[model samples]
Target: MITTKDLQHLFALIAADIAAHRDHLCELDGAIGDGDHGLAMDAGCEASVKAVAALDPAQATPAAAFNTAAKAFLNAVGASSGPLYATAFMRAGAAVKDRPDLSDEEFLRAFAAMAAGIQERGKAEPGEKTMVDAWKPAADAALDAWASGASLLECFDLAERAARQGCEATRDMTAAKGRASRLGERVIGHIDPGAASAAIIIASIAKFVEQHDSCRIDM
Candidate 1:
């Protein structure tokens, strides 16, 4: 099982992944949004890393680490995304508060809380072509997998696939929210910046935790 330390490392790996692919994300965003996705993501991830670094991982609760990352993103990222993303983390942290090792139910409930936070804060629904489009499905699938007594790794895999599919779904959708809406028909072919970045963050963290867990099992 992934512990609080793994949670901390997850954000660190996500930060590196975002840094490595910042230009590509910006390029993707340029097709529809303001083309600042890469820059925004980099700023957010850097803030997350600094926040993680500042924490005492051994002492900080899982929720505390998550809250710290969210707060940093809120302060460091100067964009609409920071607040929404922070809300996701805040909700997730609350879901898993004080829990060192999450059971299947805890994991799913935490993800569900994040989805609720997104819905409440963004007020966007499925098919709105927003980050919610990607997040809602992924969270649902993770919840389903967890509810079925699947492993945490399996839950992440399910959510990862759902997220990618959700991101792809955005490709054919006309923009209805965010800067992409300003582009009208021209936005039909590009992925949403928020969805793409969310996918990157989730998938990278999953891979990082999986590798670390495998290493521990092998040992």
Candidate 2:
């Protein structure tokens, strides 16, 4: 089962990955946006990791960790991504409310709930060249893999792959949402910063799950 400790580690991984890719993400945003997406994401994820790290593992539930991270992220980031990710973590926390640990199925549900929450909060749809492009496909791929009896680690692997593909596909799509939308066809041939960062986050989660098999529970 995945414990609160595992969740804390996952946030740390995300923070690290985001920090490393911050400049790349900003470069992508500069192609069609305000070029601050990376800065916001890096700050938010770092804040989340710090907040989650401060929680007492012996007393914190997975839901509590997620909730704490969400608040910290929202408070740290002023960009649109702030509320989007905060809602995602909030929905994930609700998906496993009162749980100290998560079973494989529970984890999948929470993962999918995060994408759903983001979509609801942002009012964005897939193919809009937003983070939803990465998150929705990743959630769907994970759920499908789980339904086919894959282990949690394999499900995460599939999710990460799907997220990567989704991020790459953004290069061919015009931005139908966000600040880039005003750019129209000029947004094409450039990857969306939000989608790219979403891929990084999913990949980090997959990497963490792979390295920590003890966190996995049976299907």
Candidate 3:
């Protein structure tokens, strides 16, 4: 079962990745964006970590922990992406509602809801040169791998690969969402900032789950 600890670990991993890739993320944003993606995400995820860490254990259920981070991310982030990402986790937490210890199926439900929420709210899709491009693929892979009776770790692995491939695919897509959409064909060949950040977060989650997972089957 995935506990609050597991969710905390996910936040920590993303925090570390944000630290390591801050400059890179900014560099990517600089290419086709306002060049503030790195700082914006760093602030958001860092605040998310602090929010999770400071959770009053007395009140810290799995759902509450996620909700706290979502709220904190919104409070700390000041970019166009902030509301989008904040909505993702907030929707996920709402999906899980009162659950404290979540099963693999529940985890799927939460994240799948997050993916769908982000897509719907952003009005974007896979290959739209947006975050949904990466997230939609990862979400699809997660569901597919799990339904095929794959181990939880295997499911994450598949999701991670799909997110990465989707990020790369954004490079060839004409931006049809966000600021990139304003550039039209000029957006092609430039990676979308939202897609890149989403890929990093998904990859970080997969890596965390694999390294700290204590119960993944060997299948």
Candidate 4:
């Protein structure tokens, strides 16, 4: 089972990973966007980690942890990406509401809910060169792997791979959404900054789950 403390650790991993890639993400955005995607994502992740870390893991449920993260992220980032991710976390929290700890299947469901929420809030579908390109495929692959009886670690591995592939695919797609869309075919050679960040987040989550496979907090 994954506890609230485990969730906290996961958030930290994501924040750290984002920090590590901040410059690269910004560089990618500079090609087709405002060039501040990395900075915005870093701020949001830092805020989310701080807020979630402040919670009492033993007392807080997974839902509470996720909701806290959502609020913090939204508060930290005012860009369009902020609202998209806030809705994602909110949907995740709702999916796991009332659960003290999370089973593998439950966690995957919450992950899927996050993707769904992003899709709804962004009004972007796959191939739109949005973050949804990465998130939606990753969620689908992870959930499908879980359904096939793969271990949680294996499911996450699949998720990371799918997210990377989706991110890469964006390089060839004409932007159909966001600021990049205004660039028309000029965006064809550049990967979407949002998609790149989404892949990074999924990779970090995958690593977290792999590292914690045998160790759990508050369990």
Superior by lDDT: candidate 1 or candidate 2: 2
What's the TM-score of each model vs. the native? 0.92, 0.96, 0.94, 0.97
Error at 200, model 2, angstroms: 0.1
* lDDT, candidate 1, 1-219, per-residue tens: 556677777788989989988998899888887788899879988998888787776788778877888899888887778888789889989999888766546656766787778778988888877878778888888878877888777888888888889988988888777878887888888788788887787678568747865887799
User: Per-residue lDDT for 134 in model 2?
Assistant: 98
Please, what is the whole-model Cα lDDT of each candidate in the order they appear?
A: 0.81, 0.94, 0.85, 0.94
lDDT of 4 by residue, 157-177 (tens): 999999999999999999888
**lDDT minimum window of 10 residues, candidate 1:** 101-110
Best first by lDDT, ranked: 4, 2, 3, 1
Q: Compose the digit string of candidate 3's lDDT tens values, residues 1-219.
A: 788887887898998898788899899888888888999999999999999988765557888988898899989997877788788888889888898688878887788888898898888767778889899999999999899898778988999999999999989988776676787898878888788888999999888778756555543
Residue range with the least summed lDDT across 10 consecutive positions in model 2: 210-219
Query: Model 4, stretches more than 4 Å misplaced?
Result: 216-219
**Clashes found in each candidate (C-alpha, N, C closer than 3 A):** 0, 0, 0, 0
